[model samples]
Target: MANQVVSLSGETTQPSRADVVIIGGGIMGVSIAYHLASAGVRGVVVIERAALGSGSSAKPLGGVRATFSDPANVALGKRSLDAYKRFGEEFGADIGLRQVGYLFLCRSEAEVLDCEASVAVQNSFGSNSRMISGAEAARINPFLDPEVLLAASFSPQDGYAEPSRAVAAYAAAAQAAGVRFLTGTEVLAVETAAGSIRSVTTNRGTIRTDSVICAAGAWSRHVGQMVGVELPVTPVRRQIGMTRQQPQPYPEVPFTLDLSTTMYFHNYGNGMLLGISNQQAPGFGRDFSFEWLGEFNAAARICAPSLAEPDLEFGWAGLYENTPDHNALIGASDEVSGFFYATGFSGHGFLQGPAVGELVRDLYLGRQGFMDVSTFSVTRFHNDDETLVREVHII
Candidate 1:
């Protein structure tokens, strides 16, 4: 198996030439490979530094929603939601898609207005997201402290899923569709000639490919750098913790998020998985900080008072590939002909993976995509035009 990689589908021999070589074996890469294979393009190869979904994809809170301020994001999310719903049936894999809904608490009038505006944007894209009063919020989620909340946004159509399982499902489907996934392989360099990607150099060996998609999540910048494209993605550390299994299981609840502190939590297995955004400068640090524990406790007390009691059974940190605007950078590169970007999703990459993969496949095949991804182009940052896509719900 030296020159071959084994996937759930079967043995995939190391290829000498591939039609497309996606950098990153996370959900984005596998999804792209799957969509491409489904489109009848078989020579697809996915290179992963570690195991699939081992990066930021593994650490997502798994909140899948279309309640976004950006129209492109909302459209992409709606498509992703549809794909996720049909995945289990189409691929014979249960993604554990629980439509528990997403409840966002807004404390201030401004935040409430923002939520209203975002809901409007989402609704325009066929998403049934709406702003609800505190009473309504409480009606949907009984455990919430409605008195403290000024307003909230709830979308029953939006929900959460098992991230690792989704990744595995996509990888399996992609492989079964004849996509080769090479794990434990680091891409050392991307060789280009005549303004197009020629091949990719990896730790194991070189694979010749005309197309390359940088879906490396937190490490996408490094992969882009190899091809002389400076991706605006920065890896920021976000911490998450889970409480011990309660003697009495928690009541079924939506994934609740506090707008003020960006603190969020939802049911995960037998424990409640919770996390908060770090205000410090962004870096590649993945070490979980004890200093964040106090902040988490304080935030939890206000947003989820019942979870205030200290019983942190486990904790970990992961990177958020953030851009200047926090919206994802998708589409083809302006400088490189065969290079594509599906990175800088901020914190919503996991939710957007399925749709983005299809979008990338469409773009690569020169077919019109399900949604117009012009707003997510990398040239947005450099262009003189002020019309750029911005996501208000970055949490």
Candidate 2:
């Protein structure tokens, strides 16, 4: 762990030195840096191939909720929610977080039963989530079509936050506490010795560090290959669109998800944000086509008919770092000592960023006595322990 910063593009340049060198400047990487600096881990440097939040962190749908069927996810989400609730007061950055609650519509009786079981697990972890009939769901969200929903799971304490603002706040706070960020620096290789990471070779320069944390999001598998370790992460393309301002008396709404159609939407100022999943293969060549607009509009119409009206404003496509089980691969690996991972979040990274930051920090500092994250280890899949937690309304 050293403190010298060397220019990567210059010839005869010595490697930059840091106690912890984190690859990727997205929410996951930046958040981990923030927590590390907060825990007094000096000489920390985070390198991003592009600008901060330019990856999956910037493109998230911004849905924050603690209503999960898995106990581990519920705990993680609740911890993140608590951190978000106090973000403005603690970091002096207004993240635009709102606790308007989330309404998860259930289209079938089986879905209702599943939601009830999920609610029980959530309540066990002190989450204020519960199951409601379709009539009660209509009362919660006046604009919702009761005929389309059989039941709903409502969590009053969960909501959404501005992704860009959250990333800025974490980066700012970490910078204030002395975390170096190098944007436009891509990690080209991981120098290893005796089965441990010695340094990271990047496009800008080589970074010598005690440890390396791979938080590269969609590109995590590529980064993993650098250390001769295979990461079970893939990039899946997803699209989201926003509608133009419309004159309507819709009440203040939490992020809503239609379980029947896998569509989700939320208030985007005077307009609304809408999106749905694309059943396609993973690749880097697919352009963000306007052809997806038809599918988006149809999904929106089924969930919220008002949004289906004319005048859609903007649309974009992003990648979801998917794993075999729709969960993140956190913690260190035996295959590559001193190389840690916090990737494959399956689109839930933004909301869970803060908690992940703290968890990785604790792991690095040998202070993870309180958190039980044994289930999320990368070895679980290898051991044939594929206990997947399926949250049906992930859009």
For each candidate, what is the lDDT?
Answer: 0.82, 0.80
Candidate 1 lDDT tens digits, 68-182? 7777888888889998899778878877788888899999999999889888888888888788998888878776788889999988888888777888888877777788888
- RMSD to the true structure for each prediction, in A, is 3.4, 4.9
> How does each model score on TM-score?
0.94, 0.92
Candidate 1: segments with Cα more than 4 A from true spot = 1-13
Model 2 stretches with alpha carbons more than 4 Å out:
1-15, 247-250, 300-303, 386-393
User: Tens digits of per-residue lDDT for model 2 on 54-133?
Assistant: 77767634778888888888888899999999998998887778889998999888888888999999999998898888
For model 2 the local lDDT of residue 38 reads 89
Residue pairs clashing in model 2 are: 8-204, 8-205
Judged by TM-score, which candidate is best?
1
